[model samples]
Target: MSNKIPYVNILQSAICIPVSDEVPIALDIKILPDKNIPAESFFGVWLLDVSGSMGGDRLENAKESLIEQIGILPDGTIFNLITFESKVNEIIKDVKITNKSRQEIIKKIQGITERGTTSLYTALEKSLEILRKYSRTNGSLAIRKIILISDGEPTDVHVRSGEENDPNYQKYFMLAKEALEYKSSIDTVGALGEHNVYLMYEIAKLSTGKYIFAENEEELKTKMIIATEQTARIAFSSPTLAVTSITGDIELEDAAQYKPTVIRMPFEKINKRESKAYLRSFEAGDTYQILVKGKIFIDKNNIQTETNVKVLELDFDFGKDGLRETKEIFITFSSDSSKFKLNQDINRKYANVFSQAEEIADCTIRGDAAATQKIQGDETKKID
Candidate 1:
């Protein structure tokens, strides 16, 4: 029997109709993972900012947090460390961090102190090179990632006066774009310092990775751990949802890809008034429902295996609001047009509820405030 679980799970709301003129209705859908397997070998590359701005407690706290992260990693994980001043410095190449070299790794981490200007582009370039080499030689058995922690803006150490043309704003994005070719990612951690927040965000976004911002040293520690843990859980392959069937002329609006071939579910689509009227025309005193169809695709053969290492075990959430294995979107149609008014308050409220839910999820991911109270309330209810 295969040990692998379903790669992606479907989660969606089932609409209940008291009455509708039409037998089926349109519904929104979301794709979520049921469980994720940890990679057999994780290739971690740390891009640290050792500039003048990161001097004193800021730098010290960063080093300490990084040390804690190192202490918790499982054996046989290959990693590299790169620190940036005015230039990029590689403390280690792609080395499998074992007990013998762990001490040496610690020493190198401690030796890094604040010095020159921050050259983020150079560091990222070096990081990507390491990932490419590893992928070619070691094969596709590792979850390769670059962890970037920076406190200041990108500076050109050689550009004394005017903006230096070569490795400017475009350089950062170019490096991110290059990493994608090798299936490598760059997860950026933004700390307290003067820098372009959007730059850090774009670096993560373009690489199909994560971006976390810390307001203080304490938060930085928490965020770093979160990033590392997530990096380790990189899925073997991205799953695509194949729409099996549709009952209505519902639009699939827009979709945003979260990972390779992984589309976040319940994408927004504008429903035309005509589509609404067709369903609303159903006679009163009758109830109807629509079924949307899809299945998650997982390529198990591409999943890599390691010698002597047991796969990391993780659990799946099957709660109603938790991760679901499959989705059944029930669009209820009622004969009482007044009770289930298509254009009136009933349908409007239904759309508003789902719209707000999607917005809340977006804000939470961005760490911004948008109906924060409602989000907290929903979360609290889930916990209880």
Candidate 2:
């Protein structure tokens, strides 16, 4: 018997709907897991950008936030700190940390002077390489994160004339692409870069991770703390299938004016009695969950793993079940301008459950289990 769960994210009834005002959506998943897992059984990588742009309060705040994060990891979680500048620095290579080792990592964070230009490509390549290598050797489910923290574009790094084409941004994307292809997540944080928020958002979307943009040092720390803290607080993955079925959505008025009042459902053994339950109801300005608690997963052989997500819709349908059939919602997630906003809301609503997903991702990261280093930041990194 293989140990994998596979499900599909389906958006039934309508492709798009209109709303005069915005509404909130909550997630509710139901599943059956074999056993219990701890949050610490995962692996994570902190890819910090130490370019000239990261100087002063930005760099200080980055290190300060990281030091505080190290103390929060669970017992078996492994952390690799990758800082990038003119080159990628393995500030702390796959360190199995304890309270004592945590102090050492903090000491190294202090030694960083924050000089040179940003080399995001190299750092991402190295981070993915480590993740793949560990995944290959460990032979267990792991969640590897390629966390890139940058405040600007690649212009500052000035890719070498000949080397420019050698390790281009595409290469880092390929690694990021592979992580997404393999059901892993990649989160990015760019401090003091409101103009560069779009780029960070792309990286996060491609890898099923979240991106944070901060315009100042204070917001930077708060965002960073929130992102990491989320890893230890959310747990909406077990006992149910969580996958985002629809990536792009539009208002009905904006969408060719097709209300799609109702669609038919198909079933081999259609029962007239259950027909009423299948009819979707719709109102002018009301939003509905087209598909509620829909199960979706990826099958890695028999290890059916489910991505914790909910596929909701703003439109509802009231139709006969005669045409009801399981649909494989086929829609490639294009770069929707609204996706970033929806993703952030979804993340915040399920922040508490995500802590559990972090545990699942951590178990997949490679490295020997060692004690964690304990480093507390100046009483200021709190995410109030």
Candidate 3:
């Protein structure tokens, strides 16, 4: 017998609630793949903050982290380094990873010094410019990313002292707005210094990138490694689930937008990630449509793009009803009391599990050990 491999498979479990007019359904969607091939070509930008606040040990540790990161990246990946203070300075341009270039990068990294105010927005823009310019050169097929390491907010007294309605007030917004337009992902490293964590978190979240809040130099190095490794291991880029049709009061839970459902699948975190949308119907038989669309860049020589949509038009013994089973979902509605109870029990059990899972996630995000332990105990009891 010959073996076969599948790109994706859906194991769907669902629960439904009956109503006077429509049926409400909840589904648990788990997208699974037997294996994934990582992208080979990668272009990265190191936007280092050398502001005066990053003086002494902070600057030294940051420089060391940069050097270590450069030393560890796999060969054939291309990267650039830039330092931002009162102005933006590009220390290195797009150079393919090699022993010689790596040494040059490390030597330049050690030469960096902290002195001036932070020109955060300028640095962000400059990094994007470099990524865009080099991304198309030499017919390169690569994943692009910007690793922004900063110890403080964007501050320049010159911009602050300018005329009324200074651009400084809107620099963050401007950077975020522009960054969204570019396809390159941004991973932010907020080092321990006088800075706005919330602002950094928002930038990372909106860019669909990873946000690392480093409390010390060691953590900073670890987070950098994590970011680089995660970038290298990206299994999917620009993954999207598009909903083509909907009926009744069916609402999509995680849809960024509807009416040709555009699932918000960010480019940064795409490995085994889950996307969900919900539906509620007043009638027994109602249907919806979804199209899974994405492109797989195999290599510079061959880039494959595919858009697969769920076939929505179905014909039955009766006739075409403009309804069909979604690839990952099938709904069955009945008035049987016993069946209803079974579905209800399943729904309640999973609902409790989901609630506990969410609680654990919240506690973990907030770094609350006490709350996490309590919630974890509750989860264990439920599981038992």
Can you tell me which runs of candidate 1 are displaced by over 4 Å? Answer: 1-40, 138-140, 157-170, 235-384
Q: Which candidate is the best by TM-score?
A: 3
CA shift of 130, model 3, Å: 2.3
Candidate 1 lDDT tens digits, 36-135: 3433447789999989988888788888888877776667778799999898998887667688777878888888888999988788888888888877
Local accuracy by lDDT, each model: 0.52, 0.46, 0.51
TM-score of 1: 0.60
Off by over 4 Å in 3: 1-23, 32-39, 135-139, 156-181, 246-250, 255-326, 341-384
lDDT at 151 for candidate 2? 78
TM-score of each: 0.60, 0.53, 0.64
Best to worst by lDDT, what's the order? 1, 3, 2
Best by lDDT: 1
**Candidate 1 local distance difference test against the native:** 0.52
Compute the lDDT for candidate 3.
Answer: 0.51
- Which scores better on TM-score, 1 or 3? 3
lDDT of 2 by residue, 1-384 (tens): 012221223223222222212323333221222223234334678888888878899888887888777777665567788888888888888776677788888898888888887777677778888787776676243444556778766553233322223344344556766765443467777566422433454455445465555668977777777666555432321111112223322111101001121111111112211111221112112222222212222222322112222233222111222212232333122234353223344334244333333332232121101100001011112221
